[model samples]
Each structure stands twice: as structure tokens, then as C-alpha cells.
Target chain A: MDNYNYASFPLDMDDAVFGAFRTQAPAAGDPAPDGPVTDLATGQRAPLSALWRSGPAVIEFGSYT
Target chain B: MEDLAARLGPRGFAFAFLYVREAHPGELAGHHATFAGKCDLARRLRDRWQIARPILVDDLDGPLHAAYGMLPNMTYIVGQGGRVLYRAMWTDAASIEWACDYLQREAQERRTSKRVAPFYSELRGFRAHDQYARIFMNGLLEGGGRRAADEFVAATEATEGRAAADRLRAARQELPEARP
Candidate 1:
């Protein structure tokens, strides 16, 4: 089991926002990865990386659509 | 989070999710950008989460958010003296539960020790949470809800003490564009 410490990460909205934008969304027509996914509440386009660091995330793709 | 809030009640701790700007507004690769509808998305999420606590809307001007330097999905526990005690961001559930238990203990100990001033002393952490909830609701209404805004106007008046009505006038002065 992973031990999560709030202080370890501290709170930096800047870094989190920056890192989210750096990740690439999956390409159109790409096969969906196997798992449950939840889309971001905003219907904005986002790379798979920005979807979430871990756990389920919402997504859109050509293959799925 | 709603379940946790319910369990903790007004005495344990209140949770509020501040909806800041979208990290990735239009696309994943873009730099910080703002979205028109993202705030609504946040509202929906709060509702879906069944969060009973308040979720305040941080405006485009970013006044409140700038004050807190808040990160997404972060939780802060403010003790009875208006002091922040526990803070967590990008957390795991198990750890958060443990921290919550610890917070409850701390609140209890503070109460038992009777170290706090009477006026500032809290019997349950929930009261503070409720207060924040009321404040946040007013803020949320101020964001766009007509009734919420009206209610907030009233609340501001009440809480502002002898200057309640005057504060409303000041608030009106603060937002000139809001005038007819």
C-alpha cells in the first residue's frame, strides 16, 4: 500500500496546472484503453495524461465515438 | 466527500471545494487558459458528489484563490481559533480518514483543556464548518444565482453587525457596474 502524505506534495496549483497541460491527449481513432474512465466536467479537449494521474477519468476519442 | 462530511457533521469538519480556473481549459497541451463553462462543470460535480458543504466559486479576478494559493482537490482543516491545522492535496482516502480522526481528537482535547477564549471556543468543529457553509453559499449566489445573491445580501447585512445595511451599500459601491 502506498502511504500518502499531504505535506510531502505540499500545495502548488501552479505546478499541477502546468503538469496537466504538458501531458498529451490520445490521438483520434486510437483504440480506447481497457478500464473505466470519467471525462472532465468541462467538455474541453484534454490529453490522456491530463485526464488524471491515476484512477478513472472521462475522455473522448474517435474510436469510442 | 459528502459522506465524509455527513459523518463528521457540523462538529467534525466542513469541506468546501473552491472552483478555480481550469488547469487545461481548451486543450491538454495549452498553457493556463480560462473556460466560460468550466464553473458550471464544477457546480455539477459538486452536486453529483452530493456534497452538502459549500462550494465557493472563485472568480476570474481570483481574489479569494490568490489569498489561499489553493490547489485542486485540496482540503484544509481550520481549528476553533480560526487557525488552519490540517491540509491535504491530491490525497488518498485511508490517509485522509486517519488525519480526520486525529483532527477530531485535537478538537476534543482543545475543548477539554479549556484553553481557548470563551467567545472563540467551539463545542463542535461542525459549527465552524456550518459558518463557512453559510458564507460559501452567499459567495456561490454572488457568482450568478439570483436568489443566492439576494440571500447573501441579507446575510452580509446581518453578519456585518451595526454596519449591516451600510456594508450592503458599500458592497454596492464596490461593484459599480452592477448598478442600473
Candidate 2:
């Protein structure tokens, strides 16, 4: 995906970009990727596992827009 | 999501919102040029929305978001072992709550009932959601300002709006004529 800067925000004609680039979601029981995430308050990078180490977690992903 | 967090938080369920690239970038919120800029937008989003759950911002390229499927407003349930328990293309609070409740009950059954053995299974294709125009428009406005919202409206008008209206008209035509 190209950099979605302000100028390039509406570059895609429709949702074609998503259709082409959307990744298949991890199925149930699959190991969730433990990628690094940035904490909003502290700006410190931490492992994604930190969120669910104690128990299960419901994580919602989206942008401000 | 806040309500879900509150309802299920005590039940050993955690919640967080992962901030990603703007879904509809425009002038106001625009695209995140830098990680710092993305964080700033995320902070503003938190303050503006008064989100209670912990906000975790993704990296600029969104490796995690892409890995988990790039659909906007997607949700996932990660268990203690970092295993995906549930995932949905769209975030529906009712569906999420149902999944959590079901999982918790299964856990309880495993602990208390020796007869029932837990096994992995996938339940899918149960889709119900509310898509109100006002809410969508609000998000567009927040992200890209008037231009984004306007463009979205125009696009919808060109595609879904006309197609849906045409389909509705055709369906009506198939119905028996009303008595005078």
C-alpha cells in the first residue's frame, strides 16, 4: 500500500485497494501475531503479547478517520 | 467497546483499541505522515472520543494491521496464549459480547464439568450490524473534514445508492398491484 498521506488519501478510486491488499484474518485458535505496538501515553514500543498476558483481550483495530 | 470492557473486564477479559492509518484521509485528520503525527492524531481521537480502553497505535506501515486483515473496524479476541479466539470483519458489540460470554462459559464448563471436553471449533457467517449514515459521516468528517465526507457521499451515490434503489424498485415491481 502506498503512503496514505493527505494528498494521496483519496487516490484509490473505490475500495479496490482493500480488495487487492486486505490480508486474510487469522482463524480461531491460530497464534495471534505478537508484533510490537506503541503506547499512546508513553510512546514506548512493547510486545503485542503484553495486552493479553494476564487473560483474554478484545482488541479493536481502526484509524481516527 | 467501553461497555463491553466494563461488562467483561472483571471476567478476566482485557480490551484495547489499536490505532491505524486513516481510513478516509483528508485535510482535517489527513494521513499520518510520521509516527509522531499518527500518535498525535491518536491522542486527539482518544480525547475527542473519550475512549476508556487503552489506546495502542500501530507503526507507520501497519504491519500488524495488514497481518490481521486490513478491514476497518475489525475486532479480535486474543486468549491468554496469544491465540485468536474470535475475529470479525466488522466490530459489532453484541457479537463480541456473545463471543466473550460463550468463551467464559466454556472455560467454566471445562473447570467444573469433567464430562465435557473442550475442543476448537469455528462459528462463522452470523452477521448483524447497524450501519447508520450519520455515524459514518461523523467519522469521515472527523478524519478528512468536509472534503472526505463529501467525496464519500458522492461515491456512495454513484454506486450503492443507485444500485440499492434500483433493486428496491425492481422488487416492488414484482409485487402484486394494490387494489384501488
Which ranges in model 1 have alpha carbons more than 4 Å from their true place? A1-65, B27-38, B114-180
Sliding window of 10 residues with minimal summed lDDT for model 1 chain B:
B24-33
What TM-score do all the candidates reach, one by one?
A: 0.40, 0.81
**Interface RMSD after interface superposition, model 1:** 20.7
Q: Please name the candidate that would achieve the greatest DockQ relative to the true structure.
A: 2
Error of 2 at B121 (Å): 5.5
What lDDT would candidate 1 get against the real structure?
A: 0.38
**In order, what lDDT does every prediction score?**
0.38, 0.75
What are the interface RMSDs of all the models?
A: 20.7, 2.7
Chain A only TM-scores, each candidate in turn: 0.22, 0.65
lDDT of 1 by residue, B1-180 (tens): 555655655443544445554332212111122434545555555555554554444444443333333334444444433443443334344444565686566557776885643232211122234344345433333433434344445544544444754555455444533356
Per-residue C-alpha lDDT of model 1 across residues A1-65, encoded as one tens digit per residue: 12111212113424443244213211222232222222334334332232223311221110000
Model number with the top lDDT: 2
Model 2: DockQ against the native? 0.57
